[model samples]
Target: MTLASTLLWGVAHLAAERRRTGLALMVAHVLMLAGVLTVFTAFSVDLLSLAVQPRWLIVLTVALVVIALAWTGVIVWSFLLVRPPRSDTVGRLLTTTLTIALCALVLAPTAYGARLAYVSRDVVNSLFSTTSSTPVVAEDPWSGAERVNFLLVGADAAPGRPGVRTDSMTVASVDTETGATTLFGLPRNLEQVRFPAGPARDRFPGGFTGSVPDTPGLLNEVFQYAEDHPDMVPGVQKGKRGPALLKQTIGDILGLPVNYYAMVDMKGFAELVDAMGGVKVTIEDPIVYGRSREGLLPPGTRKLTGEQALWYGRSRTDSDDYVRMGRQKCLLNAVAKQADPMTVLNSFERLAAATKRAISTDLPQELLPAAVDLAQRVKDTRIRSLSFVPPLINTAYPDWSQIRRKVSEALSHRPSTRSATAGRPRSPERTPEAPVSLDATCR
Candidate 1:
């Protein structure tokens, strides 16, 4: 309606006998054309591809909004101040009222769009400003051929604890073109985790053999140990000593290059779930939480709140660590499948706040466009998961070669069953097997 009205008004004024009115109408028409061009430019170009700082993004957003408001004011002024010649009192009154109404219609969407854009920019700036405690280098742009691997570390940090321990660790490797993802869950208790040929390897020639009383020579402790003794990994970057060392350690163990790491605070995991209005999952077994054994989450498909989902992923009162790992994987798959754009947009502020507080990653902001594309591909593809547990490999003394080969096979081969979707029932054969379909487990 606004566009049509603007067009009609432009034509009327362009054909006006008075020079002042015609000139004013031409200026207004040009401003309208400029607005249309601005919108087109926004859609055509990757505005975020520019390597601008967060401060610049803020400045640009504010400038654009100011310009929009100024243009709106100009539009109103041009229509109101520029009077048509030989107009009667009632005619002039009606024209002024119609002009105001038209301007309001045009300004409403313009202001709303500008506000949304500003909010989005602010959110991205907030996320980008959240730097890790350590220095990290950015990776080269992805070529869409090789796999991009992200180390998803779930950190369990309790009050009064000396250091944080990564309770759950998984490598999510996505195929560049296909979006097919393979999740390799590293057992926390996995012993003799070899470090790559470096200072780290020289320090522990026989692999990471250090241990505390509770978790003896476990894979998870490597992070805390490295964090405490940064000198062990000589020349390691500050604020990134732990994650860098762990990334290398896990990379060497899996025989795959770990591109990035996202450490999620387990304590804030519930907040993240709540931010997304909770995630729906098909619970295969009864999940028990709390010390009294009374907080029971019964089996069946159900939507879980933040606290319930956290326990669903982290609890091991009724089961063991390995079982808990599987549950975590299921929860992850469910979140990935269910947290679509609409869901996140609906609770955007909450989700953004939760994410900023809970998560930290070394993934470069420049690669977000590629990451988003890859994520879309992953959503459509079958996500296969492989965990080094039980018959597959002993956590006490894991066969490193066997583990690597399983990771390789899972990534190379397509699952025999149909591509898994969230909330669907799984076949009996697909239940908790090695290279299990995450969709099936999360179903």
Candidate 2:
């Protein structure tokens, strides 16, 4: 409405000045306005669906660029047509210079904005291009569900490795309305994880006991296993062969339907962190880096670089997997709390490029807008975390029923005294060995 009123006023003013110049200016303004409106409408109307089609996006971008350039030319021509004739050479030269400067001042930002839009569109196209082979669902799988579950996998793929292993496995279950999120971290070494009754179950009757060379059939191996033995789950979609199997297997174990899966390459994860200007984390213990464990990350609250943060989350030479999981959760919480909308908008180009290179997901493109809204809501909500490790649950032979019960209990939102003590001050030296709830505001 504002843009419409402004366009109307501009046309009126131009028309009142001179008939010929006004007509020319009005035509140019109308074309530019129409082009701008069309682009905006495209963004608001099922943009995610359109974004997956690179060719259409490229065409639209080119058209907008052409219109912008032509609009500039018309504005300059109209200015010359309307300007008063100067008798002296110096006066005429000064008038022309000022007019050009004025035009540049007005058009510079518009051109810059158009360029950013083009870059953003290209980033979206690139993100989808790599994952084009991933299966597309007919409709949102969790359309009617009160809660949505996403399987987050951190793949560790070093050079020359034949296949990658999902070293980090977490299920983020979020309440659709409240945006209350519960992060359930499953131990990578967890064994005896059952699959739903079907061909998957038929193959692994005793819950994934098959061995792959030196590696055992642990929970983390599910993704790579599915990739290697695609024929095992013939009914599953061809594009989502690996993630679908892992989702099913993980879903059966947790007694919840996994709606989607997002796999992050470890290297790309570091780049993303760097792009976000590094995430602030409270390191409770010293973290060792590299296979030699020679490089040490001192403990304290500090902003860590991409390399430091990655090793801090994945390092297990000096610490155990449970501790690493805790650190990873802490890093994630810090990112969630600190990477506000403004921060992301400021660093959008870099972040988008890094994300495109690092992340792969089975999430449908149509649901991205809703997911963004949900993320905004999540920023205001406190995130509760639970890790299945050690005394909590046996990794060698996990009690599937017990784990499911825990997950259900956590999601049930049972009244507890823990919520009251969540924000209370605690001694710096008295950090809990295992924290059920994390303070989102903690530095």
Q: Each model's TM-score?
A: 0.75, 0.76
- Candidate lDDT (C-alpha), each: 0.72, 0.71
Q: Per-residue lDDT tens digits of candidate 2, residues 57-83?
A: 676567656755665555555545444
* Model 1's TM-score against the true structure: 0.75
Model 1 misplaced stretches (Cα beyond 4 Å): 1-67, 78-140, 143-145, 159-161, 211-215, 291-294, 414-439
Best by TM-score: 2
Query: Which residue pairs of candidate 2 clash?
Result: none
| Worst 10-residue lDDT window, candidate 1 | 422-431
lDDT of 2: 0.71
